[model samples]
Target chain A: GAGVSQSPSNKVTEKGKDVELRCDPISGHTALYWYRQSLGQGLEFLIYFQGNSAPDKSGLPSDRFSAERTGGSVSTLTIQRTQQEDSAVYLCASSPAGDTEAFFGQGTRLTVV
Target chain B: AQSVTQPDIHITVSEGASLELRCNYSYGATPYLFWYVQSPGQGLQLLLKYFSGDTLVQGIKGFEAEFKRSQSSFNLRKPSVHWSDAAEYFCAVERGATLGRLYFGRGTQLTVWP
Candidate 1:
């Protein structure tokens, strides 16, 4: 892909339903990151995957939220039993091996009703 | 714990006026600094970054930022503001020792008045 690609530009679901967000990073990029952006708020880091191992999962908001990356190319972020607070734009970014600047995707706007 | 702070919530400036947005970060050691801009309903785009070099760094869209270690600040500046520059600006920092985790500030909204 020319740049990072995210699926489901917008998602609306019931409060208790689960949702899966996908991200296809730029080819050969070694670092992928997930972030959440609430209304009028800055991005909050969720998880970072370097290769297959996520050395830093400290940013995950809760146990209900989990993410995994396979083949170091695509990543999926799953939110189990979504809540109103989970209604936000889920963003994904990827950077080259050196980790200088990151390229971001359009993001999935999640709405919990 | 590493965090970024952007004190001003909203700022309004006339077009062609000078603009400056402040950012502060807390980290044990010198960290990688970055500035990103987000337009309404758009994804974030990198403006500039500072790892280790001259304190001042230039970025796309005529944006620039300076990393100040003593005051723990990395402020974005534009010589002359434009109406199109109206957007939300964010400050981010990566703890150097740590690999890919980036801490971001609350953000500042810039409003340009014509």
Candidate 2:
């Protein structure tokens, strides 16, 4: 079966710019999550979506970050006026339900110069 | 808040040698523990997880982890090492009530030398 996939394996952008990262979860998966991994830091949760309800945005660092999922299959994360601090590997994952293990995508390495 | 700790930032082992990666966690209740491996240019892949019941759980790629409730530890181990196993290993602990958020450790980088 096809696993989760993310586009633009590597991305470079100037500071104050905007960027969008896309993810395609496994078929039939109902739970989606986004995380950020910095240089020497642990994976930081950004947002989560389950069954089309309001997504959990508490983990999102600031208003600059937002994500959307359409038809319960694909997701896109948008960063507005990105900063150098936003430079990191953005990872996406999906699970069958709340308690199951989540599978991850290869990630989009975002670099803000 | 729930948190995870991987005391050793890096570990080096020779091929065919035994391997152990330590993980410690802090949570209010019984925690859901997991080990994941991230190869270069790839996403994290689940190695194993511990929910309830058996203290020892087996996972993909010939890996296993043991949860020691008394010590707040869930260490991952393999009887022998392979060069392919060289990667970043992260320990994660999910609080029972948190639902979807997984708190991850800083990670341990394994170097397998032949």
- What is the lDDT for B98 in model 2? 43
Per-candidate Cα lDDT values, in order, are 0.91, 0.90
Question: If you assessed candidate 1 against the hidden native complex, which CAPRI class would it receive?
Answer: medium
- What is the per-candidate TM-score for chain B? 0.95, 0.96
Candidate 2 residues lying further than 4 Å off, grouped into runs, are: none
Q: What TM-score does each of the candidates earn?
A: 0.95, 0.96
Local error of candidate 1 at residue A28 (angstroms): 1.2
lDDT tens digits, residues B1-114, model 1? 667899999999999999999999987788999899999888889999898889999999999998889999999999999999999999898885556567889889999999
lDDT of 2 by residue, B8-105 (tens): 99999999999999999887687888999999989999999989999999999899999999999999999999999999999998775446568899
Error of 1 at B46 (Å): 0.5
- Model 1, A34-103: lDDT tens digits are 9999866557889888997798888898999999999989999999999999999999999999876889
